[model samples]
Every structure is written in C-alpha cells, then in structure tokens.
Target: MYDRLHHFYQHALALDNTPAPDKLTLHFPNDRPRKLVLDKSKLSQAEIALLNTLFHTNVAVHHQVTQENEWLYEWLINGHSPPKHKLERLTPPPLRCIHFSIKGELNEIDAFIEAIKNVFPSVTNLLWKSRTEGVLLQHLPEDTVEEELSVESIIDTLATDFLIQTSFFIGSPIDSSHLLYERFKWETTLYDAVKMTFRKKSFFYEQEIVTYYLLHHIPESTLKLVSTMLDSVMNDRELIHSIKTYLECNMNTSLAAKKMYVHRNTLQYRVDKFIEKTAIDIKQFANAAAVYLLILRLEAK
Candidate 1:
C-alpha cells in the first residue's frame, strides 16, 4: 500500500510516514499497524474522508500542540481564518514573530519550548505551525545585540538538547496586532524562499535577507539590465569580492581592508578602480546596493 501510494503521488507526499500538523492523515486500522498517508494538498477534504472510510479509520491531527489553539488551528491546518472576531483578538504589539523550522521529527518539544522562553523571556504567543515548524510572537527586549546572541544560543541548545538541527527567521516587528496574520504570512513565505535558495545559512534576519529575496524573484531580463551597471568589473572576481566585503562592512575602508587582509590604502585603491571602471560610486548606499545585487546575480550563476 505504501509503495503504491508513494509511486503515484510521491511528488506531493511527505518523504516519511510522519504527517505534517497541517495535513490530514489516516492512522492504521485494527487489521494492521502502519500509517496510511495521502497528499492533502492534492486531495480535497471530502476525497480524503472517503479514503479514510475505505481504510476503516478516522483522520488524525498530526500533533497535539496544534489542537490547543482553535483559532490558530483553523488558520494553520485549514489555511483559513477561524473568524474575523477571533483574529481581531490578538494581543497588543510591539510583538515580533520568530519562525523556527525543525529539520527532523523532534521529540523534545517541551525542552524546545523551554529553550525558546529561556532565551526570549517576553514570549506572549506560541503555536506549532506543523509537526516540524513553530512560531513565537514575543514582546522584544530592548537590547538589540543581545537578541541576536540569544537566537544563536537557541540553535546551540537545540543541537545539544534535542539532537536535531533547526533554523530561525527573526521577523520585523508588527507595530499593530491586527496585522499579525498578513505580516507573518508574508515574512514566512519570503524566509522559506530565501532558505531554499541559500541553504548554507541557518539563521536569517528579515532586514538582511529581504533584498536577496526580492532580487531572486526578478526576471532574468531585469537582472541583465542591473548587470550592465557593473559591466567592466563583472569578470574581476577579486575587485568584485572586495567591494562586496567593503559594502557589507558599511563602506569603512579600514574595516573592509582588515576583513580582506589588505592595507587600508590598497582597499581604497580597488574601490577607486571600481568607481573608475563602472562610473558608479558605491560610496552611497543606494548605488552600492545595485552593485551588490549585481554581484549576487553573477555569483548565483
């Protein structure tokens, strides 16, 4: 049964038998002790229900945590709101939503929640979006630098405590509670694309990744036009990388030079050469951004 199901709908089915919190699953009946899975995204609710009846079993929610928040469950599981009134009851903001993705099935959910709370003590809302993903809505503490360190600590602890890998996208603050759903949906969607495109990085910040995320969506013809801005320097790998490092270091010649292992003067000379060739002074942030995105487009190829 498993082999036949996998052969037909493997493109949409989960790789393993474990179901997502948002997916519908039919547990084994009295005749056998194995899970019967289906791709909920490809099947209507009524269609899945007929299969559930054929299997002589009832459908089950993949995880217990999702069941606790009826309103959250509706949004996450059903991919729709519970009702207008329920959504409007969200807690007041300056709340920031942090999205976490688990790499494998995690058994230490209790420990994981504790870890999140220990690092971010201001957590006001928590929900399991899927069996392997969670979200937290928290009132941010004032220490900006500390917030990043704490998120890193959570990753470290997850490796040690849960023995599973994970990543987080720390989202921008939602100034109003009413905009939570719209804002979260947008942020999470962008983070997912960025994470897929840049699989090497584990942590993503909204402010840091948004530029690349937007650039990734542009047409190739549009990218080519941006590419022309740095036409001469496109093949100069050293100069391009140095400028990228320099811009990323906030155009501080000394700092950029230190990171590039070159003298301050040498770094400035490369910067001068770049400006001379491209006629685009990267000293300004806007011009630098265009050049930066162009370099990224080249590297991606």
Candidate 2:
C-alpha cells in the first residue's frame, strides 16, 4: 500500500516544480530514515480529512500501525516487506528477525541503533516502533541462522559506552514475508519470557530454550513442584547463578567454574549443596529438564 504510493509520489515530485501543489510528508517517529509523501492535490476531501485524523487528531501515526496487528507498519517503513496486502501474496526471500528492547534515554537508544547499523551493514531493515523498542530484520543464507550474527561484542560496547540495559530475541529465519508477522509475535513471547531472568544479558536465541518454550503454560502443580525442589536456593542469588551456569555449561563443573571465575572445588560444593537441598540431581536429564523449566517459572513469577 505505502510502497506504491511512495513511488508514485516520487515520480510526481520529479515531474513537478515548486508552487505546483500542497505536498504532505509524514515522517515516522523512529530511528529508520523513512516517511510517506502525500500529494495533497491528488487526494479527495475525504482522503485529506482521513490523513488529518491519522496524523494529527486521533493518534501518533507510527504507533497507530503497531497497535493494529494486521498492519505490517514497521516492516513497510524499514523496507523489509511491502505493504501488508501485497506482502501476503508474494513469497519473499529468507529473512530473520531480532527483536530488541533497550532501556535508556532517547539519545542512548538512537546511539545503540546506529551502532547496530554500522556493525551489520547488510542488515535488511532496522525499524523502531517507539523510542526504545524495535525489530531488526535481516537477510541471511539458508541454514546459516546459527552460524552468523554475534551480538555479544556489539552489545558490550553499547552497554559500556551508553550505560544502558539492552536485550534481544532472535527468531528463526522464515522464507516468506507472510510468515514474518507471526514470527514477530513469537519473538515478543520469547522476549517477555526472558526479560526478567536475563535482564543483565545481551541476547537470547529461541533455540537455546526450546524445552521451556511453553513455560508460561506449564500446569501450576508442576510449577509448584519445581518451586519446592529449589526452595532452599530460592533467594540465594549466588547459588542460583551457580546452578544456572553449571547447567548452561552442560553439567561440567570445571568449565562452569572457569566461566564464573571460581575454583572447581567451590563450584562442586555449590552444585552438591544444591543437590542435597533440592534432592533433584540436576545431572540427570529428567531432573535437569524440570529444574530448567522451574527456573523459567520462578523468573516469570
């Protein structure tokens, strides 16, 4: 919808000179440098009134589209996909989306986005829905989703330079633009699930927590059992960190200790204490799965 209009407007602007007609340009309120060019002379009275309502009286134009689920407003502005109507009909190239939420001032958010664009020059689209939240959709070769794109170094620089907390949720690559809308929704779900638990972290890949994908829907009885299992270390931040690191390191005490900058003996003691208190040997597959889901549940609470 907007693309066709944009091209047409550009053509009209090229052919005409000044004092030709009233031109209305609607600038999107985001980091992306894009806007809609409306030739007022080409619009009917009704159309003009509608634009007024959309841009002025009723709501903020950028936010309006985000609130409407069916509208692919962000993608359209960032040139990730065409208008919603046409995008649904055409098959687009494989693209991946990384949804991000940055907590900071407007300037900090802008700096972070600029840094991202500088790092990933091939980034297909970087769309900001608001002052501090947006999605970055990029084109990548098929089956290379896991290999490409490391946001750790970029995030570390941004965190240190800008003094902000930033997090990202990377969704799987999809072949069609039509699937992006649903994929974006899934990214949002994953982001919300990890936000509280991983506040100090940089990013979370959807594949990393596949087992806890439905953590929010787990039955209360099961959740309670998990809560009970880890009740002793419920409020112990250090102990909880030890367990999380140990599990993430695949039950390797030496590696986990190295990552935590602690001695192996200290790490083993913490792991043993956790087992003694919970009586749930995290070394076991089933017990590990339960504890993993329990961690998500606890953080969500």
Candidate 3:
C-alpha cells in the first residue's frame, strides 16, 4: 500500500507542462481494475468471502470501500441497506472490499485519514458531491466554467498546514533559519517556512534577533547569576575600568596598570576587592571563562 501511494505521488510530480488535476481522480478502465467496491448492505457477506479467498481467515471486517461508477469511496457506514437502482446505474458497480490481516489496525486508518485531511480538506466535500454528481458521468464541458484547483494552491495550503503544525508542536515562533535547521533539518521545510514568514513581513539581517531569542530560552537562574556578578563590582568604576583594561591586555596586570596610570600595587588592591565581592578568582582561568562569555553576549546586544 505504501509503495502504491508513493508511485501515485511520483507520477503526480512528473507532470511537466500538463495541467494538474483538481482532485485525485483515478480512472479505472473496463479492463483490469485493482480495487473492489462493495454495497453497504451486502458488505458483511462480501467481507466474509474476501477473507476466505484471500486469507482463509474468519475474522470480522469493519471496513469497506463503496464503488461509485467513477470514484471509490472508502465507507465507514454501518449494516447493509437494499441495493438501490441508482447504484446499479453506475457504469461500474461498486464492489465491497474486506481485509482479514491480523496486523490490520484502527491506528493505521486514523493516521491515513489525518495525513489525507492535511493535504485535502475537501475529502469529505468530494464525498458529499459524489452523492449528487452521479457515477461515471462525462467530464465537465470545456466551455462550462468552474473554479479549478491548481498545483500551486494545493502546495501552498499543504506548506501552511505543515508550518502551523510544526509551530504548535515545537511551542515556539520558529522564526529563524538556524532554529529551524536545528529542529527540522529538512532544507525544503525550512525554506518554505522562512519564505512564508518573510512574505508576511521583512526580515532584516537577523543574527542579533536570533541571538536574543536564543538567550531568552536560557535558564533564569543562570542569567541571574551573571547579573549578580556584574552588579557586585558595578559601584567601583575605577576598579571596573582596571579589570576591563587588564582583560583587554590579555590579563597582563602590569600593562593594565601602566595604561590606567596607576601603580601596580594599587591595581592589585582593586583586583583583590573585585574577587572578594564577586567570589570569582580571575587567576583561575576556568572561573573567569563564563564571565568573559557573558560579557561578550552583553556587548553584542
């Protein structure tokens, strides 16, 4: 079944200049058709026969496809009704279909319907139209104008549906290529979402915006810790200037003291006070690494 569906999609994509169909309309020739259509009323008996012939199993069948002359409707209706004359009028009578595989499960049907719904909200609409459109009728007259579905419209709708679903599941706005790349990793998916988002508004060089939002997801406690460290040494502007100079000089305290026009001993005194207030020993490179990174982030913003 998966292979069959894949082939159908591949064929659809292969169409070049040919106009795309409005809906998935399969035409079964008078020769060999791969599907069976069942009457809603005689479904039970048809299901039993199908199971016996195909699987030699006596399992109950809960699903069947109703054959309209031109289209097949997978039925979810209940017990049989009498065969109406209208059903016979269909060029090709509907055949009842049944499967008795032990692996057959309701979840498969649910998944299929869910996927189909995403691509075509008009599935039920088509079914409703089938009731009035009649089976095996001639194609609409070329001069008879009607609204037609286009490949572009269908593709756009599917793309929008995917973005909505992805955003809802990811719980974020998903506005950047980097975030999208990390999450979905599909180039096409990322391209479509980014294009759609850009269409609604202009996106400037977004590196700064991406960094800001990335930081927003960081833990509050971690941000608070960084904030507290910066605040502790904020009052001593001279000491702060000395420390910044020292870092700028690649941690050469003598060079920093010379640049600040201060004695080395006085610079050392301020460094000690900074350590005491922040409880961060700058002499140990590992402890100073996080502070340096935070400073870079702050400066970037």
Candidate 4:
C-alpha cells in the first residue's frame, strides 16, 4: 500500500501535475481494497492511460467534487508556477537597456549573466520575460565613466574571457516612464542592425547606425564631397582596408595592429599616411563618421 502511494506521488511530480491544495480522501465502490481519487483525473492523458494500463482495473475518473474556493483550485490546477526574478517587478528611472543573445551551453548563459552583474553592478534589472531570446538588463548609470564602462568593457570581457559567441545591443539612457518603451524599440532596432550590418562586432550601439542611415539619405552632391574627401585612398585597397579597420576598432592602434597582423608602430604609420593623404583625422568621431559614410558611398557607386 505504501509503495503504491509512493509511485503515485512520483508520477505526479514527473508529470508536473498540479493537484488541488485541499485534497479529499477517496472511497472506491464494491468495497475494493484499493482507493480511487478524484484528483488523479487532473493527470495528463498520457498519465491516465498509464494508470489504467498498470492498475488493470477501471479507476472511477468521472467524479467531480465542487469546492467553495474555486479560485484557489483554479490557480493550483494550472501547471507549476515559475519562480520570479527581481527584474520582473521593478521599473526605475534613468535606465539603459543591454539586450544580450548567447549561442552556447545553458551554463554559459548563466555565467555570462553573472559576469555582467559583477562587471556592471549598477544593473538594476535582469529580465527574461520573453521566451524567444536572451536577457535584457536595465543599467542605472552612476557617472559618465561608469556608463561608458558598461558597454565597451562588457564586450571585451565577454569576448576575451568567455569565448562564447554573443552580441549586445545597447539603447540610450531614458528616465521617463513613457519613454521606456522607446528604449526597448531602440534596442531591437540596434539588434537587427547589428545582425544585418556589423556581424563581426561583439556589441553595438544605436548611435553607430547613424553613419549607415546618412548613406541612405544624403544628397548626391553631399556624397560627392564625401567621395572627394576619401578619393586619395579609395584606389588603394590595402590602405583603404587598413584605415577602415582602424576606424572600426575605435581608432585603437594596438587592437587594429593586432587585427591587421602588423606591429603597432607599423599600423600607426599606415594610419598616419592615410590621414595625411585623405586630410581627415580618423581619430576624431566626426572625421571617422565622414570617412565611414564615404566608404559606403564609394561602395554603392
């Protein structure tokens, strides 16, 4: 008798069955030794088939007992409730969203989240409301340096330490309750933009897409000026590739040097020569933005 009850309990757990909180004792007809319960009917169809086949006797499953507190019963009758995280409940001001997508083992996903929390302790919320993809983090900026640290350093660490393929789409900071959804839309736009355009980057910002946006919208006369600005290096594929790579790497000599498989000094010399010929200081964001658009313009031409 004890073994039978134990098996039933195990089956219930395995099926994720939710029985009524207020359980009632069962009394079978014809004075049978084994008792049948109404709650067993809540078991899924597969479990019911198994029970009927295993017991070799028809269990009385037609009985439905009415309870006064139907609301609580309804709640329990649904599948087990999922544990909620802190992010599921909070909405705060001045939040920056970082949308992360992972492509590795499940443990890696948890490790990645922990790593982000450790690196950016200002993360106010870590959410997984959607079933489709990765976690969305709500980062509260403390200062300018901390805000910058959240994006670049996180990307570097995720790449250098974890070796897991990932992409982080960052949205601008927002303070108003009404503007929170705007931030989410921006994050999604950046995510799709990164996937489509900047496949090699570990993370990307919505602001970076402005260069491409300009390429599509700028007038032809303006594009000609852009082309004229970059024409000196346009025909030189090696120099062009080097300069583009340097700009893409945020003008970091060491990183660009490593990427180009050239020494730091050598990469610097190439960058200086490219700047001297083009008359554009690629180190400055404005000049880089121009050169970036010019590159796209030339490509389109």
Candidate 5:
C-alpha cells in the first residue's frame, strides 16, 4: 500500500507538469531548510488534503532536482536549523492520524472508504494501493468521544467493556500469568503509556487512573489513626452531619450552627472536638476539608 501510494504521488506530480523542480527550498520560522523533490506527479487531491489536515496548514510544495536527498538527514541531526525559533511556530499544532487497510471486493472497499470519508471529511489520504490488496486511508485528528463523568467511573466502564468483549473467548478460570497483580496497577500503567503516546496528538478519550498505593503503603500507626477516627465518629451521626454541613458552608461556624439549628458555642465545641479527635485542624480550612471529604468518600463506599 505504501509503495503504491508513493508511486501514485510521484505520478500525480508528473501529471501536474510540475516535474520536480530543481533546488526548491522552504525556510521555516527557525530558518531551517527542508528540501525534497516529487519523483512523479501521481499524488491525488485526497493525499494532499490529508497532508494539509495533519499539518493544520498548507505546506509549500518544493521540488529539488540538483540537491542530494539530504533534507531529511539534516533536519533530523541539526534539530530544525537556525536553532532560535521552533518548527511548531511555522507549522500547525500536532495532529493524530488513524490508518486503515481495507481488502476484498473493490466495490465494498470503495463503499467503506467513502463511508469513512463522509463521516470524517478532514481525512484526505486515500489510496488504492493495489486492485487485489485494497485501499489505505489515513484520517487525521483521531476521533474522540467526551462525556460528563468522573474519572473513576470512566475507568470502571472501560474495564467492564473490556471484560465483556473478552468474555466469550475465555473458559472458566481465565489465564492470568500475563496480568499485573492489582487491577489498578494495570490501569495506571496502561494510562501512563497511552498518555505518553496519544494523549495530546489524538482526540480519542481515555480514563486517567489514580493509584491508591500511598494509602495502602502507609504506616500501620497512620492507618490506625484513620481507622480510630472513623470508628469514634461512626456512631456520632449528628456530629458527623453537623461537621459536614459546617465544612460545606466554608467553615463559617455561625452559618453552620444556624443551619443546624444550634447555638454558635455548641457548633464551636463540636468542631473543636472533631479536630481533636481526628488530629485534623478544622481552622486551617484546606487540610481539614481534604480529610473531611476523604472520610465522606470512604464512608459512602
């Protein structure tokens, strides 16, 4: 497919009568030089469109006949010459490209390709590499679906979906040798790797996983402190409710007391005791709020 596309591009160039000019050069913002020649004029409008879509801007076509094929080599080694400016400044933001290889009947392949094109008009590169092989289509700025939901919820959905897809293929007592010990560990590792590769370039969305290793690895004493705090206030539903209400009210003792239909002094004493018992200072606001929320989340689960 790649070879056919290359051939087609060259043929298109030839057909355009723009037969690879001699010594054509392009100066980027960084004063970097990129030199290349169209071996032929076989490029299609779709291919050109794909390139434009990926770059987010039109690229000045250059044809160099005299110079050796040193443009790619120099650009890679010299780091986009001139060194002062950046290539990104001259070009558009990075884009993602999704490549598809279709085979089988020509009519069927053409229909499929057309369907994709209709949905993704920005996709420009479509090449019928061979009659029997099929077409190769490249779509820039990969598709992404966004929804209003929590990250954890998103991860859970993904995990569930994955299990459903693989469920039919596996028998009882599925193989686990290749799997990581903790599901969250696998999730985090996959998240980091995917983010590194496709997070910015592609529009496709994925969940960001948070590890609970910090909590799990904490000292036993610290764990005990958290447990003790939960147990002590576990039965004190009224106090817990009041404290939550007060915190949610921005730690305004007067407002919280009024909301709870209690005297300001009474609210103050409860708040003070909450701080003392949990070793979390409610006066500091931020830290107190974090602990308060953490407890609430844990309790809800």
Candidate 6:
C-alpha cells in the first residue's frame, strides 16, 4: 500500500528521513517509521482534508525549509550542489557523511552536538536534515593508529542523553568534492530505508548498501518464488539456519560449522544433503545471491 500510494505521486519521498520542504510530509499512525512525502502545492485544503479523512493520517505542510543553515538548506532541501565557496573554504577532502536516524524527539540539540564531537574527534562539519535526521561530516584521519570509534558507544551516548534510539550509516569516503552532496543524499535515502530493520543501536557501512537496495526493490512475489527453489531448506529449521550461515560464511564448511557450533563433518553432510535435495549449486555467486536474498526476504517477513 505504501509503495502503491508512493508510486502514484511523482514527488513521493517514500519514508525519507529528511522530508524536503517542497514536499508535504504525511505520517500515518500505522506506518510510524515512514513519512509519505508529496508536493502539497498540488493539494488544496479541501483535497488535503479529504485525504486526511480517507487515509486517517496527518499532513504536515512544510513552510519553506528555512530553519537550517543557508548552504545546508539548499544542498539537502533544494537538492542543489554545495556552494563552491563553502567547499573551497571548509577543510580539505576525505570527508564522508555519517547519516543518522533516531526514533524519538530530540529536545537537547546542544547536547547532541557535543556527543557527536566526543564520538568523532575528526568531525569536520555537521548539519541536521530534520528533527529525526542528521548528517555528520567527518575528516577521516590519514594515519590508522588513532582510537577506533565504537558505534555502540556513540549510540549509547545519544540514547542516554537524548532518550532516542539512534542508528547511523557511515558512507564511503567522498572521492570527489563535487559528488559530496549527491552521495550524501543517496546514503541518507538508504539509511532511512534500512534503519528500521536494525533492532539495536548500531551502524552500517557501504558494503551492505547494494544488498539493502535489492531488498527494497525486489517484489514479494518474486521473493516468494525464489524461496520455492529451496523450499525443503526453508521448511527444515536446521537446514535453513545451516545453509544461511554457510552461505554467509562464504561457503566455508569449517568456518560455518565453527560459527554455528556444529562439527565440520556434520555441516558438510548438511550441505551435501541440501544440494542433493534442491539441486542448487550454492557455491556459485549467482546461486548464493538468490538464496541469500531469499533468506533475507523471509527474515524480513
């Protein structure tokens, strides 16, 4: 339903954390983690009232997103390139975006900023996309010996201070300064979609971005069909767990057995049995990808 309604509107931001000022941010009581954004200019008060009555949701008419800094407002809200002057003026390259998503309200903006600086000493810049959305610009150090940043620590700090369970995604380093805005926006969209799946306060990186994209774009019908390819494995709880762990461990029998607390020979037997039952050459990347996605699809369901 969310996707159908989202497709109908040309400017829908299907669960975007940073709701553009040009779009109307609608919140449904049922869909708490998502905000269906649309161009409110295209909706009259009468139409808006009717929509409210029909969908049982509230529409927040954003009045020109001018609350943030001028450059940030333009870059994030208007989807404009970062000002050349600011790019030239600020610190050098190697800055990457850390897109954050928090569940509840943030009453202490000052404290939140302090916590960010504490967690990331090399943080060169920062900006809030919305109350629930923010971006931290970090200048990753050239040297590798510095203290490693623990995502759990940062998550705990924010949760204790702001009383909101937060999740963040560390984007790939911006190779080109010109692509900074575009790349950050893309990561923010991905973060918004993937954050809800993570139960604990933690972080993710660029490696999982493509997997999440497939999860978002693939239809349930196709996933259901894919599951049928390995229905026997899916039906048996042990084979399901064993195969998933084995594939996730890169099809290494001993490593998967160690991870799953099973003997190597036992895992190898299970693997052979699964291949004989399904006739799937799970060692191949393509076959592994389909099975991995099927497992993820069922887990998500």
Candidate 5, residue 184: how far the Cα is off, in Å: 24
The better-scoring model by TM-score among 2 and 6 is: 6
Top candidate when judged by TM-score against the true structure: 6
Clashing pairs in 4: none
Which residue pairs clash in candidate 1?
Answer: none
lDDT of 5 at 42: 39
Error of 4 at 252 (Å): 13
Residues 224-250, candidate 3: write the lDDT tens digits.
Answer: 667677787766767766776766566
Off by over 4 Å in 1: 1-68, 83-89, 104-107, 141-154, 218-241, 254-263, 273-281, 284-287, 297-301
How do the residues 153-251 of candidate 4 rate in per-residue lDDT, one tens digit apiece? 666667777775666766677776345544564455446444544455556565765554445456788777657777678888888888888887888
Alpha-carbon runs more than 4 Å astray in model 4: 1-89, 129-132, 141-147, 150-153, 159-163, 212-238, 241-289, 296-301
Q: Each prediction's Cα lDDT score?
A: 0.71, 0.64, 0.38, 0.56, 0.39, 0.70
Whole-model alpha-carbon lDDT for candidate 6 = 0.70
lDDT for each residue of candidate 5 in 151-259, tens digit (9 for 90 to 100): 2443343334332110000001112311211221233233323323322222112221121222233455665556565666668888788888888788899999999
Give candidate 5 misplaced runs (Cα > 4 Å). 1-225
- C-alpha RMSD values across all candidates: 6.2, 12.3, 23.4, 16.7, 21.0, 7.2
For candidate 5, give the lDDT of residue 291.
63
Ranking by lDDT: 1, 6, 2, 4, 5, 3
Off by over 4 Å in 3: 1-221, 298-301
Where is model 6 more than 4 Å wrong at Cα? 1-70, 80-83, 145-163, 196-203, 235-238, 260-262
lDDT of 2: 0.64
lDDT of 1 by residue, 229-288 (tens): 787887888988899999889899999999888999999999999999989999988998
Q: Supply the TM-score for candidate 4.
A: 0.47
Worst 10 residues of 1 by lDDT: 56-65
Compared with the true structure, the alpha-carbon lDDT of candidate 1 equals 0.71
Error of 4 at 200 (Å): 1.4
